[model samples]
Target: MATDTDFIHRVGDLAPALRSGGQRLHRPLLLLWALAQAVNGKPRQQPWSAIRASVTPLLATYAAAPGDQAAVYPFWALRNSNLWEVEGSEELSLTSDGRRPTLSVLNERDPLAGLLAEDHDLLRREPSVAARTASSVLLRFFPDVMVDLARDLDLTTLLAGGIDGALRPRVGEPYANRTAIAAVYGGNGVGGITPLADGILSVYSDDKGPYDDRRVAGMDWIAYTGDGLAGDQKMSGGNRSMSTYRAEQRPLRYWHKPHGGVFTFETWVVIVQCRQRWGVGQNREPRREYVWILAPVPSPLRATWPEEVKEALAQDVADDLKVHDDLDVDLPPVALGDPQGAMTDMERYRKLSAAARRTAAGRTDRSKLTKVERYVRSTAARQAVILRSGGRCENPTCLGHPTELTDKGDPLLEVDHVHELSRGGGDTPESMIALCPNCHTLKTRGSGRQQLRQALLVRAKALHRSFAGSQGEDEKRREPTTGQPL
Candidate 1:
């Protein structure tokens, strides 16, 4: 039950108290951009990922205050106005104040937000109203940049009382081959990369092509090799397109040619991570290349993804946070210490562990492990341990949260098992402990694995006891004190 008039009223009154201090264009800019989307007949529900990549730069450009500008602030705050609607609010765990989702949660979870659907529809139908709302934003917040903004967004169409009817580019259905794909999508169709529809794509094949794309087993994402056959890969060209921070982000498309069949659109993707590592180029010379870690664009709400895929995606996302420790994320929960939730999560991991063992039953050795998404371990168990670790390495030798923290202001730690799960260890909190990536690798694959394991076993036992004692204290504090007023 929304109308263009209601939205116009709300839009005009956005953050009025804050506006009195200085003209802040963050929310107004978002509104204008959304209005433009409506004028062009785009979908009402815009993904946060898309909005981040699109509006963040604009916020940096237009905001009056240096410290208060961020796409996340406006995108999350606008819902209070009732003009904007978010698709994934319930799933958000929120902050300690029970206010907003954390930056990490907002970044990792692909929540959809934009103008209310009814308002979007009405705005699209009545261009004059849309134009009026936009004019008000210009007159109030960013009058100086109205002409520049108009040029950038091509707002002339809307201001002239018309819809541009801009069509979103799509990857349609399967193509006969790379050739067939290029014919329609307009790429060279020779290598892994295809430039089409304002996005970059990567193809995976067994053939010895220029790009040696590999989807490792038990992993949902692909380590997409950067373009160029020789030397270290640079952060230019198609490689830039895959990086979210480099001002080259675009919609990521996953095009697969399975069993050497016709090329098919797999799913839309967003880069979970990107890393440069030592490798051999196509010509077999020593080189390093950027590996763009691509995960499926998560659903706006609850994921309908395959179980294995979802599991691996969860692991990759955690890995992504670890790798980019300093990257800023918005707000959500690793802190409430919800024991019941942790218990349920741990039980789910137990099943995943057994399933993983069954899937790899016939594999001769670890080296021969098939490139199918099956893992004999649980990311949930790992995460539970990480939660228990409180962000610092659990090793007694390194017992404090690191100086460096993940964007969400949490410590980066890896869950390590005191006894190997593969060697018949239980999948419970006591069996696993969290450590920093350094200690984890040293314990699992280093020379003194036995010594580290023994030390971790002792430390983990003490850690759990401490956690239990702390929980009891917290409960006692929450309960009424003896002889207190009831």
Candidate 2:
């Protein structure tokens, strides 16, 4: 029979011995052993059922010896039992136990523990474990990793395509692996190991300062071109093919070429068409407008183009100018700034002009305008009526708000007529007003909105008929149908 001293020694040796055996014990068994050692050699016996109830499911078993059997027989319980020890029980009680058994046992045997333990140790050592933990929690609940990555990819592609990096800020460093991971894992950042086989990875070096003269120092550069934007560069998944390239390194500068003209004149123009029908408020007219913009082409032009190509382009521009007096309205000017400079500038100018025009169009206050004055006035007046209607559909049941702002902060409010203009609804403030984009689209597409309206009207008519029928029945029951007060 084991003596009390021997039992104590055995209890002390259990964890180290188990660690040395190199046996991969099930976690539940390990926990039971730890808890058993924690309550070793007490006077009063712990109820087996209570112990089992406390640790069942998590621990495989819970057993204890009675009286002196406690010293000789090895007891078993849960690893969590070390959290408490029983009071008044001279033997072991969990209520008296302070340290949790699993942690304590693991700590004691740490030096001798094998591969599984090493893996746990590695997790503890990771610098990003805390951040990864928080990220894991968010990902677990809301799986939007791929959606976010797609958005990132779009922005990176735009920037790599010579779009303004400042205007299109990049997210975290574009990792080649992340793209493949996203693709294979349903864009949620999990599973799959196949490498992407077909894409181009472009690297962009962000200038540390506004001026190119200042070198990007030791700061870790932001990466924008990788698998995220270009898909898997190594794999051909039949998805969209993507490529990235660095923008022109030169700063924005205008290049001017002298034409045979007495005055050095440059001009820009913008023309926009409202693609959707149903103009401002009740008006169902498509608004079409254009603007003329001018800036002198810079003097002392330098071209990266081959001499022959440059000469050909210059001749082409000259020919076009001779054919059309208003170059701004007739053709897009040759971007003389650098490679792809003209296209980039034109796009930027278009966005800026659109924003300005939208603001001007929405304003209720009258302002001066050179051209398209009548059109602008009409747009503003219609917008004013739409705004006055609480910026929602006039229809009581149409739960649609009128104005919505775009990502770039432009208002996207549309005026919707209560009745279709084609059906003889005259263009008047009373006939039309503001409606949300969704409602306008629904109404235009001949979708369920019209059906829903018809259904509601039908339901209302039926309800009225039912009430009238009930009143007639009541009159018949109360008196002869010859009109008598009940």
Candidate 3:
């Protein structure tokens, strides 16, 4: 429904409204430089020096006099016209008059952020759009001067998509464009481009950039304490209590990278919503859904969670879920929470036997156990250990394969702690062992339990070695044997 005229008017209407000065060529020239950068495949934002270098030649050829031109003036003040936006400016010290900062301040702070990504896309998709915008600026402000300068810079073809039908440096003379863009792709600076085929790994060489490659299963699991380290903000659902902060669409900031010794950078994202889903028996367990909606706001800016609450109805999306987590319910219901009045006859006997495990030592202080303790006993970890063990008891001394599958289609095996919790053992995967009822009873109650424990430890270590050695091996070659009972 939109036409090219709408685009031209949008670009042309951004004339600055300076309080005292007459019309100036700064905004148009800045726009032209930005357009040129887009044509040449440069980043959206150019450094101030790049802007100065790129536009200086044009200004020198068209200025009224020798001392009447400055790049910083337009770069800093163009934001007033809504034609430009700058960040890293708040860090700069402002003058008393509250006017635009001096060139020195701008240079020191280097707040010359680039235009919006959408505008860059517009210029790229329709070179004629930029050409028309430039023509409008010249016709409106400096008809006479622009006439001569336009011709000298080959503006006719440049604005009209040139001989090759693109607004770029002439064919086979790529460096013919602006000096700053030349300096960038020409590989003259530290922030220059590198080819991946060279086998040199650099952050700049990576096409996905830093943030896009790092994916978390759920945003709710991520903690943004405003700290810079991933270890400082560990990813765990148990550690997070989202009840205090109701899930809603809101601004969220996450640590990016180290900017300096004292502070770090952050990427902003919107917490679209907090979602909850129940599996077959997941009602006893809580899990948060992490779905990223295409953000309605701009990127690389800080967004905060809203304190005020608003009600909104939920709508269904058709996209397939990429990842889903369901608690491992194959173990005895005791490992999960006790299901009131639902204990099977076999489970009742197991619970009575487990009660016999109680020594003079008091019951485990469950309240005092950290989330790390809970994670050791988590459904994910339990499933991982069992599946890796291949649906059989892991004791090395005896053969006790699962005779049947649980209701969840998992092998029926008892989960045993390699070291008893009362004996000061932590509930880690390495410390947890899967066993059949016979092996579990023998290891938990029979004589030579310490010897059996030693044998299970050896088998567990062998499994780890097999999994580790799986790298570079064929799938069939890497397949693990069905575990044996102790």
Cα RMSD, each candidate: 23.3, 31.1, 21.2
| Rank by TM-score (best first) | 1, 3, 2
List the global CA lDDT of all models.
0.56, 0.27, 0.43
What digit string (tens of lDDT, one per residue) describes model 3 on residues 1-486?
334444443554564443333446666667666666776577888777677666677665564312323776677776665546777767766667777677677667666666666677777677666675555455344544554655654465555542222212111232222233324222112221111111111111111121111222212222112111122222233113221112222232222232222111123344323222111222323222222222212331122222211111022111122222221322333333234367643343233222222211243544311221232224333443564456677776655554455544446776666766545553434446778877888887889888888777666646544543432134235334554321
Q: Look at candidate 3 and give me any clashing residue pairs.
A: 45-114, 251-303, 395-486
Checking candidate 1 for backbone clashes, the offending pairs are 101-331, 102-330, 102-331, 102-332, 103-329, 103-330, 103-331, 104-330
Error of 3 at 344 (Å): 99
Candidate achieving higher lDDT, 1 or 2: 1
**Tens digits of per-residue lDDT for model 2, 1-486:** 322222222222222113332322233233222223222322222433333333333222112112321211122321222312223223332224542223233223321211122222322343232122222221211122312322322222212322212210122323333344334212222211111111111112222211111111111111111122211123122111111001101111111112231211111101111011111111221222111111111211122323432342344345442211111221121212222343443333233223323433333422211122223223332433333433334434555554455332324446544455344332333334455576567656745767744443333223222323453234235433442111
RMSD to native, candidate 1: 23.3
Count clashing residue pairs per candidate: 8, 23, 3
lDDT: worst 10-residue window of model 2: 268-277
- Model 2: CA > 4 A from native: 1-375, 393-395, 399-404, 407-412, 419-425, 448-486
TM-score of each: 0.33, 0.18, 0.30
